[model samples]
Target: MANQKLKRWLKVAGQLIIAVLAIRFVVKEIDLNELKTTLLSANFWWLILALAAFLASKFLSAFRLNFFFRALGLKLNDWFNLKLYLLGMLYNQFLPGGIGGDGYKVYLLNKWYGTPLKQLIGATLLDRVSGVVALGFLACGLAIFGHTATALGAFSFILWLGLIFAFPAYYLLVHLLFKRFKSVSHTTNLQALGVQGLQVISAFLILKSLGVENANIDYLTLFLITSVAATLPISLPGGIGVRELVMVKGAGYLLIDQTSATALATLFFIISLFSALGGLPFLRLSQPKD
Candidate 1:
């Protein structure tokens, strides 16, 4: 156990180091002043729209978990899912390891709701898988159709194909888990989440356009794909450079500039903030005992 923890720490440290190197390169090309100006200049309405979109995503996440739990014959409410997910988001942002967010998730539900350990662990895994499929579907769409995907297109397509094929097997997976590890169960409900982003043809374009323009179709798809991928157990702090790395690699497969891909990767973080923040309401509801 100690050795495993050490490895996880070492892996996380490596990711942070890589992220720092990437940020250094991104800093050289990204005009901080221009980026700031673009961010500040975003129409108030657009920000509102973005927040609305974020909330929609959060709600879908919670809703999906509820459906999945019910399918497994576990009784849970949307309110419970919302509160638990929100609390998980906050912990993931602040705490350092697996012992952080969802670890707290298992602790909370097992203690408060008195849910079986297997149900809590299994449900979280299912939630993550659904998120992956949704994200992959979006990325694949972008790679095939978006102009900039010249570099990342094939990567996205491959990922999309994988997710498409895997969707059917999710339920199968849960059954297998039940057979092998009867205590743990996986859920496969995605509720209704949407991915919407615009795009530009090139890095020069992403930098020149109003920063918030629809990500190029491919990039937009990549954003969703990466978003889903970020939820994986193997990830960087808040998925920092990992998102960029995936986008750049996938985008590169299609012809997207590394610099622009990096920039959009940053944008994905900004979007998740709203999604995370939407949980604030649920957080209020989740206040642990005084």
Candidate 2:
């Protein structure tokens, strides 16, 4: 028990350090005054739309997870599942060294519904994997359509091929390993696309809020890439630093204005933070009896 606790502590500490260093790197790369100006001048209406899109993405994400749950015979109602999902988000953002939002959900579901733990875990794991696969697919597709292909030359063809095969490969993996989830694979995958698509739209809105009227493809591509980066375990709660660092570097490579890129990342983070707070009210609520 002591060893496990120590390991968790060390992991959190390391993540915190990485998050700080990454933010520092981003701060050094961009002009702070320019970033501040951009942020302060952001259009409130666009920001509100971005927040709505982000919330919609979360709603779709909760619905997608429920599909996996239904596959396991849980059949949780959408409203209840959404509340649980938001609570999980809160735990995920605030409890890095704990059971985590997913683990907590698994524990609760097992206790309440008596589902097989293995299947519950598989459902959760597959839910995350499906999202990641979608993120990769979209990122690769964007790279092909954006300047990344031209920059990569020969390697761009590999990206194109990956984009074509990603879903098929994901389907095969599910059939082989997560047989129980195979039934809903198609539905969940489509939902994953919608979830990510809305997120990209949210990012685009954030850019518009920052007064970026053009070069949207590059910025959106970078947003997707940074999103993947933020998923790395080393990132802090809310993916604080990793996303910013990736945006700064990606902007430099793509010749985007670093200040605007930083502002966009920061705004997206803020919007996500705001959305996650929706789970706060459910935090102390009793587990649903239904």
Candidate 3:
């Protein structure tokens, strides 16, 4: 017990260190006064719209996960599933361990529904994998387009090749994950696209809120790239510092202001936190019965 506690503490410490380093880097690299000025001038209505779009994406994500649950013969009702999902999101953002959210999910579902551990774990893993795959597809599309418009070299050719093979590769992956529910693959893929599309729209709204007008494609593309980076588990507490770093650096490639990009990422993170807080009321309650 003591050893386990020590490990947990160590994990928390490590996450804190990483978060601090990431934040410090962003602070050092960007002008804080500029970031503050930009944020202070943002359109609150636009930010609200961005938050709404982000929440809609989470709802779609909840439905997508429940689809897998139905396949596992544990058809949790939509409301209950969403509540559970929000709780999981809370853990994902705030917990110390990399897989805290997913592990909590497996534990809850198994205890509440007598779900088999292997099947529950598989469903959760697949749900995560599906999102990552969608992100990969989006990033590759953006990269290919951006490179083609700006350059005509080997790097662009490689990106083109990646785009060409992305579909077939993704198709094979879908088949592997959905052999039993083959008929549902199309619907699931559509849901994934919707989720990602809304998120991209949310980013666009953030850019607009920050007064970015003409160079939206560049900013949006950079946002997508940072979105991909944020998916990695290296960042702590809602990917706080890591995301800001990615956005600030990515903005340089597009010649967008670093402070503005950081502000955008920071606002997105705040919106995410608010959404995650929706689960707080249910955090200590037992899982709802269907």
- Candidate 3 lDDT for residue 117: 88
Candidate 2 clashes between residue pairs 3 or more apart in a chain or in different chains: none
What residue pairs are clashing in model 3?
Answer: none
**lDDT by residue for model 2 (145-181), tens:** 7777776787778887879998999999998999988
TM-score of 3: 0.89
Tens digit per residue, CA lDDT, model 1, 18-126: 6677556556655566656555554555445555555566665666666655655666666767787776777676554333767777777677767788877776766
Q: Candidate 3 residues 31-50, lDDT tens each?
A: 88888888899999999999
Return whichever of 2 and 3 wins on TM-score: 2
Q: Which numbered prediction scores highest in TM-score against the true structure? A: 2
Candidate 2, residue 33: how far the Cα is off, in Å: 1.2
Candidate order (lDDT): 2, 3, 1
Q: Which candidate is the best by lDDT?
A: 2
Q: Which stretches of candidate 3 lie over 4 Å from their true place?
A: 1-8, 147-153, 174-183, 287-290
What TM-score should be assigned to candidate 1? 0.73
RMSD of each: 5.5, 1.4, 2.4
lDDT of each: 0.57, 0.87, 0.78
- For each candidate, what TM-score against the reference? 0.73, 0.96, 0.89
